[model samples]
Target: MRVSAKSDYALRALIEMTNRTAERAVSAEELGRAQEVPSGFLQAILADLRRAGIVRSQRGQSGGWRLATEPTAVSVADVIRAVDGPLVSVYDMRPESVRYQASAEVLQHVWIAARVALREVFEEVTLAQLASGDLPDAVTARTAHEDAWQSH
Candidate 1:
């Protein structure tokens, strides 16, 4: 369930774009500078986001990048998936696609539950929420638990 640096950078770029005037395009350099991400890496992330239909790029002097859709319509899961694929996987395969022997039957349920729990948080959270600093109560409550903040 670890998030990659690419996903983190993409989300940061999106948040930067979200803060801009709706019609304004943000250059990769601006986004990278604002988020402290490498400009070259940010470009690659932007390309991935564009391919995922989460962002659009413009050319010419006024050209830059903007979200393809409203921030509210783009979930954290979407951003992560755009760059990193599935949120959870067993040996790189989706939980449902894996076959388990009788002795390992319980492991399947464990994997499925893990994926579901991860989705419950990520799918419910949108880029707008992150940009606005308005997280859902469910997310806040879950993270508020003492154990949630402590290292395992």
Candidate 2:
């Protein structure tokens, strides 16, 4: 499953917010700059995040955005789902929801397995773990694989 730019940027922005010690609201501009994401695109992603209840926005001079939930409670899967919908889809349909012909009967299982594999990583990680740079052993072990850093 390919990770979308939206998910990457959303996670970056969330991590930045979590890293900041200030209680002040974080402007879209600040977040965009912090992650080096285009301000316009970042704003749209932030809107998705807000709508998902992952973030809260404030108004006025002191108003901006902040996490609606604790960092530790917000998983990477949550951010990805909030920004990009399903983790894995076959022909735009969910893996389990897709029906296959006899020849491709096994394809659905492959896609569903892909979804489960992605969840094993994303569902296991939280914004706090990412921001702290103290990833769990399971996450680190995945990194230990020599092929993990190789381009597909």
Candidate 3:
């Protein structure tokens, strides 16, 4: 359930790109500066996104970076997976692939359920909604709960 720094930075950079009106490519440096992420780390993230088909890179004077698809087609889950692998992993393995002893046999179900819970939100939100600041009703409803903001 922990969100990695790479995922956060990637989402921030993508959101910045989604908000921009310019048709020009966005340099890694510009994305890093705009999102307040480290330049080198951001470069690696951009590369990952490109390989994941979440983004496309251009070379030469007018070359930089851009989303490979429309913002609405790129969900938060997509960005997270693009930069950080699976949304949830049990010991770096898929939840269903993990085995547990009799005492903890039900733990696998918990992990699978957690993955589903994450998908319920992350997969439901897109870069367009995030960049436009017009979140889906389901997301807004979750945020409206006072308990959602308080740290346990």
Candidate 4:
């Protein structure tokens, strides 16, 4: 599955927030700058996260953004879905919702399986783990194989 720029930027911003002082909100300009994402694009992504209830914004001179919930409570998958919608979609439809005719019917199963595989990793990882530089064992194991790094 392809990861959208929105999703990547959102995750980067969220992880950066996790590393900062929770008592104070971080401004959009700061987040965008630190994450190396465009200010306008990051603003839209932050707004999406706010709408998804993953983040909360403040106003006034101290106005900025903060996580709506604990970092441990927010999964990578949650961030992706909040910004980019479904983990896997075929023509903007859920994998299970898509139908293939004839021999191509098996393609449906392939999509479903692909989604499952993505969930196993994305759902298993949380913002806290990422911020602390401590990935889950399952994730680390996958990365331990040199073949996993090679581009086909």
Residue 132: error of model 1 in Å? 0.6
Query: How does each model score on lDDT?
Result: 0.91, 0.92, 0.91, 0.94
Report the Cα RMSD per candidate: 1.1, 1.0, 0.9, 0.8
lDDT for 77 in candidate 3 is 98
Candidate 4 has a TM-score of: 0.98
Which portions of model 4 show Cα errors greater than 4 Å?
Answer: none
Instruction: Tell me the tens digit of each residue's lDDT in model 4 across 44-102.
Output: 99999999999999999999999999999999999999999999999999988988788
**TM-scores, in order shown?**
0.95, 0.96, 0.97, 0.98
Best-matching candidate per TM-score = 4
Q: What is the lDDT of residue 104 in candidate 4?
A: 99
Backbone clashes, candidate 1: 0
Model 1 lDDT tens row, 34-132: 999999999999999999999999999999998999899999999999999999888899988999899998998999999899889999999899999
Give per-residue lDDT, candidate 4, residue 99.
80
Off by over 4 Å in 3: none
TM-score sort, best first: 4, 3, 2, 1
lDDT of 1: 0.91
Which of the two, 2 or 3, has more TM-score? Answer: 3
